[model samples]
Target: MLSKIRKNLRAFSFPLWIVAASFIGTIFLVWGKGSVSGPSGNEVATVNGEGITLTEFNREYQNTVTSLKKKLGDNFRKFVKEDDIKKITLNRLITRKLLLQLAEEEGLKVSDWAVAKYIEEIPAFQENGKFSLELYKKFLESRRMTPQTFEDMVREDLLIQKVLTAVNRAPSVSQFEIKELYRKVFGKRNFKYKLFLSKDFKPQVSQKEIEEFYKNNREIFKKGERESYYVLKFPKTKEGEERARKAYKLAKEGKFKELMEMKPQPLKDKELIEKVKEKGFSFRSQENGLELAFKLKEEQYKSLNEVRGEIERALREQKALEMAKKEAETFKGELNEETGKVDVSELVKKLKLLPTTNPEELLNAKVGKKLILPVEGGFAVLVPTTEPEVNEFEEDKLKRLKEFVLNVKRDSDYQNLLNLLRQKATIKVNQSLFRSVQ
Candidate 1:
């Protein structure tokens, strides 16, 4: 009899459908707290005088976490914390209560048979590609819920869906809106341009000027406190260690580079430093010249000579951008619309050329006007050579746009309804409850 009862219980287990509505429906279920109590024992919150027990809150919280974990994988922790999850879970519970209360007020009903039919249609509760009563019962049994309890949940879920469906009906998209949207997304323009890069117009800087700039921006040359080391590696064998000792002697004689010639390998400084930290190597060991020459941690600012090349490059880029802007302004009016295309190629040879076949940035720009477009190193002088070409009307694209517009409208209305419900509902949460959960 016990085995038969277990089988029956296992057959009625709840699946994904039980929690699907909760996550999607409760996305924007944010609410403010109020002070109220109802002989509080395990109640985490209350919505419209209806108690949301800690048990229900925890169950829903776990379900939501599990779903998010599946969707976000390892990044789940990055986006959500325990406290945030708890708050959201409570909000969802409050929203669920509000919606259920609304359903009750409006006399929304879902028959037991209807709930049963919904369960039967679920693929997870099926066996051998067909719905099985035994499988359904077993599923419910595993969750420690009776068939009646699971059916009740399904009934509530169905009612919520009914309420949402009534509000979420798709709106019709006008032809004008679709056409406008199509134009915005699919518009393309051809640009003829000559780019002037910083490297091409690099201004010559004297040593005195570089020193003056460095003096003015001394803080930019400040280096972090660091420990410099002279690193050397040898094989683990006795002969290798003996050779390393010899090499250490050579290093003392300032032949560090010649010593490094014994083994030619690319030593990535950062990785080597990390490995040293992990292994807890001491300076006293002097193993394989690893601790042969080490400097005390000290703050050292970079000299003008060390960063002279970098500063020059920055100054040149600044000058180049300034010069390019002037050149583009001067060149803009010289070429007329008819001759612009022919002049572009000759101008490109003189400056850095950036010819975009269909430039999205200039989609709405006039064909004859020259634009000073910023590039990575400098700027470009561009003219839209061709008007944006709109493709022939596509039925599939129009249909998709209509559906997209409908969904957007539905979402907005649904959110507004939720906000209105919150105004009408009285919600109180126990702030202390979240501390224990974490």
Candidate 2:
């Protein structure tokens, strides 16, 4: 759980001290029993000679999965993969180890009194706005943790927090930078634009053009070899293997009804196309499970006649885009500079001309200047109708902008520090053991 919270703590936008204050109670639960250990063959990785055990990795990984499930709910699987979570968990562990090592080298120390004071401030261990020993003990007992163990984790977190604070001290912004940032944030400019879209300039495409395009870009029409298969995927364990063998026997005996009753998934495994011949089955081992694949469909590509309409439509769009660009270029050359306006009322009646604001370009463009810019799906001719101006001075707004600039600088510094540490450190990972971890 501390690993998960530390992941959030890395965001320098939020003050590290504030995060530590709020999450002090939950941080101790990260390594309940496996907080301390010696070197072992079960190590997943080592950072600067310090080994990260498998027990620590599994605990952190489970915590991350549980946290994400709660936050994302049913959409969890769509956004995150198990393998990615594992990799992230491992990286967090490595980074945490590095930060702690750096803290030690810098002579950072969290006294017992400091830990006690920090614990007293946590709301979870307080009753009626005061520290309660009874509540603290009860909290630890409920989680099956000793006071010493919890205090140790709190101290480590404090040390890391100190290192982060020292590295991310607020940077000083110059007066010129402040004025420039204020202008960029509050400045606005008025402009008039006329857009030319391919759909509006419909061009006729001949049959010969379609055939010629298809001939030149045959690979674009080529499709990947697809296969339909019935997969019986099970855990890579003894019992799972036994069930797979029985299912394979039923499949060979043509008892598809029984196989279907066993809940074999009717899926497509494109990667197994060449390995599994038609009307034959193959046993394959995956990272998380073993599968029996029964091939169903053969590989084939679509004929030219089947894609003729698609090719024709593509050619028409291409010709239309070319004509639209040509027309826009002509209008750009013949535009009236003094008036700096084009009648787009008729085009607006036909299609939406969404306004796009680019602050940098708007600030740079002089009054009455004309610019031909490329927009989504077309080109646009723009004329600056008004000059850019900054907002009126406000003390509160200026303070907030200064804080924002400092936060950005701190975030950059933190990342650079981590990158430098990684380059100078010797890190080794046990790939085979890591992959074999369930």
Candidate 3:
């Protein structure tokens, strides 16, 4: 869990889109004559003349990498192109710069102390439910962060959150809409579902059905190839990191105080921290560093490499379990006898899987793979169903469908707004810089 939460960011994170706001304008960037100049010549643009320096850009880019590593996991660095991450990061920064500038224009002022307080409140930097000076110091030491740098991140997070909250001031749905949503989302139906295993139909499936299904649902069938993944993680809450750094410092300074007096951080999980310590894993003042945990001959603490093999084994076992569940109610259908042995067209229509010209009965399909088979059960290969057959669109379902359509329209409108922002802003990217990074 610590590994997962620390610095993880995936492709699904904030997309490069502009949010609609009655508010407009960028924040006035506070950089003197010696402002950080962005790598690109075109540094000052929309907001209060904030210069995007190479240093600042690099910082953002590194942050992007850190976040992606957190989300996609440690392996993300190997799989994701650094250039791609930079472009995405740069665009996001610019959009944010514009939004923040607008927020400034609207007279939104966040205090430095507020930022500090917010940072103090973060649970990750806490130990024993209180903000620890040791925790803060350790984080700065390990990640090479200064109090100012940490404060800036907190401020920016709060600033963006404030801006977004303001934009969505009237967060609401109508009573009728809420009722309809509740019914559609939470309501359970008693309608019986019949299984039509595609394997049974596979015997009679023809080339025509195969070709047609392939033509229609080919996109779904095509899978993106996997890439090598690389990940680097910053230890959780600086506790583990602090433990390492303190020992390293002591080793260098020759300060040996096992019962070192240190206060915990605000909002930290004290109970959990105590539990970890109770497990014969007390922080050794100047011991063998992280080696203390890994070097133990007993099973209490396994080396990271040792733990990974077990993790992989567990994953494989989980996959086996899922495959078993999917095969139990499987069905297959086909059109061997044309006239009416089974109405080839009707069977295809009922099953909803697009029929291919030729069908192969796949007994086992891994979760990642999509398969079309006609077995003795019931389902036959046909066009993937968008909605139930003409006879099957139930009463409440129609209403739900209408709402879904509206939501799609709203999403489309949001995208259009983002495109407009992109146009209005002067965004210049240092592609060469990014290319090298990638």
Candidate 4:
């Protein structure tokens, strides 16, 4: 159950909040706070007068934290802050409330039998892959939740799912639409292109320019202090600890060759470099009784002379690219489409014209149209030589394309529906309570 919650939380995205809500289901059922006395007190937020209680918000926040902690381990704080997590949790709750209210307004109903079946199908309440009444009772009892409350939560979940499914139904696809999409995906065109290669253009670089570049971009030339260290890691056993101690003693005495015989690898952890700044021996312990030892090396950097050749090459490439773009633009300006006097075929032969496979630009380009398009290594002046032709249709490929188009339409429709609902609904949030969330 924890693993399932973690997986859903990790995969949660704001646009697909409805899908995440479906996975969350009645997990919050156990966290139910008994009847709200007033809208302003315990309720964290209200969706069209429906209160999302503080207890519910807290539980959701804790569940989100648990899921993230399990997934990210010790590095969880590095990725997300507490304030961000709180905002995500509250927004999710508000969205869920909005959808559920929308479901009620749309008259979406969930039957008692449907709710019962959903609860029965839950693996947590099952024994030996079959629904067990005894396990179900015990599970609810352990969570301090009654069967009535749990079943009601399940019914609400079912209604939300049903309404989302109804709203996101795939729209009808016309034959013309499919054919156009088919052409777009599988069409091919013959195009002639003259690529301006930067390597072919040699731009003169002066010694003064190289020196100025080196001075201006000193940070790029500057290398960080790097220290290499050998790590001797051993398992959690008694024998492992003894071996680690022996390895550490040898490492301190500069017996690296003897340490190499013990199979210690080079330590590459950046954190260790910060901890052990000086050249000496360092020891650490890891999970499950694992022991480790490190022997550090003095940090060093290279002189400017060592990287002068690299800097010169970079400057030359920069100037060459600029030259290539200008030359391509100049050639593009020379061609006259109306007069047809440019003899493109003769120029193609003389300049070694390359074939363009950029389908998007090619599809949009009409015959006799010339485009100055950017290409790898430089720019290219492209002209479509032939009209686009749809390739032979394969059933599998067309089916995939149809599905892709349908999904895009559905996603757009779903977002539009959510926007309309949000615009109509009166959502009131308790800012004080939300700020109090830790």
* Order by lDDT, highest first: 2, 4, 1, 3
Q: Output the number of the lDDT-best candidate.
A: 2
Clashing pairs in 2: none
Give the clash count for each candidate: 15, 0, 71, 0
**How do all models score by TM-score?**
0.61, 0.60, 0.42, 0.66
lDDT of 3 at 331: 36
* Consecutive 10-residue window with the lowest summed lDDT within model 4: 25-34
Per-residue lDDT for 227 in model 4? 47
Error of 2 at 195 (Å): 3.5
Q: Write the per-residue lDDT of candidate 3 for residues 1-438, one digit (tens) a residue.
A: 212211221111332222433222222222212223234553422223465556566766776777778879989968777556765565666666755664455455567767667667767789889988888888889877788887775666555545454433212346456444443333322211234442322133344544554455445443353211111122445576766666445434533233132222222345534543344233333332232211111113333344444444444444443443354335343323221222223444444534442322221122223343343333322222121113233558656655665566544443343454455554544445545543
Error of 3 at 317 (Å): 31
* Best candidate, TM-score: 4
Q: Rank by TM-score, descending?
A: 4, 1, 2, 3
Per-residue lDDT for 261-343 in model 1, tens only? 56534334675556544542222344443333322244678988899999887776677778766776676444332313222
Candidates 3 and 4, the one with greater TM-score = 4
Please provide, for model 4 over 408-437, each residue's C-alpha lDDT reduced to its tens digit, 9 standing for 90 to 100: 876666656556666676667777777787
Report per-prediction Cα RMSD to one decimal. Answer: 13.3, 12.8, 21.9, 14.2
